[model samples]
Target: MKDLACQQFQDTVAEFLIRHQSILDIISKSQESNARVNRAVVKAVTHCGCVKVRAEKSAIPPEATLADLKQLLDSHLDGELCPNCREIIESEMGKSIFYLTALCHSLGLSLADVLQREHEKVSTLRVFNFT
Candidate 1:
């Protein structure tokens, strides 16, 4: 619940910027076209500061945990992104969702349970606030 609480805070700021006329128009067009443009923009270019893979053969390293991600990123960044910065994005994207599952091992809640609880909070807040 605490982790979910913080993610909501980060999402609020992102939603605010994306609510602009030009931003919303771009999002709407991508949705209408059923294009990967929206996802590429949001996931990589917007937040992660990378682009979607342009070639098929080059592989991103397998990221199953924060440590795994750190290794993969370290190999690329060479200390460019500080540890704190890396943690923030990974937590936001829940990029290593598999890591979340591992972290939740033996816990009763499923991913669906976690998502529903988090979504419920967002749904209740029509206007985003960092409460």
Candidate 2:
């Protein structure tokens, strides 16, 4: 079901992305979309004041294990995105996904397969994946 949705989205993007058919265009647009997504998050934090980031160094004990690090670390994000900010963020994220899917289409890759492989890797590796 998820794969079907991904394929449908990819097909839609391939159909509509007439102007950016070149690989270079697709790559550049993908980067631009990612930047837009980042900008939206920054706007939410800086302009909206709905969310605050209190990032700081994590103070881990000398005796702490790898699993204990998860409990000690924090995202440092405070509060939730207000409706307006949330909408903007979601729209920007959608554009990112669209361009990502377009890239996959241009490369003859399946976004669903890529997501599934990553999911399996993380599930199997668990906390050790990053390390």
Task: Give the true-structure RMSD of model 2.
Answer: 0.8
Q: Residue by residue across 50-111, what tens digits does model 1's lDDT show?
A: 43333334345664544454444322322243454455555544433433443233243455
**lDDT accuracy of residue 41 in candidate 2:** 93
**What are the models' TM-scores?**
0.28, 0.96
Count backbone clashes in candidate 1. Answer: 0
Q: List the residue pairs that clash in candidate 1.
A: none
The candidate maximizing lDDT is 2
Candidates in order have lDDT scores of 0.45, 0.94
- Model 2 gets an lDDT of 0.94
Considering summed lDDT, which 10 consecutive residues are worst modelled in model 2?
5-14
lDDT of model 2, residue 125: 99
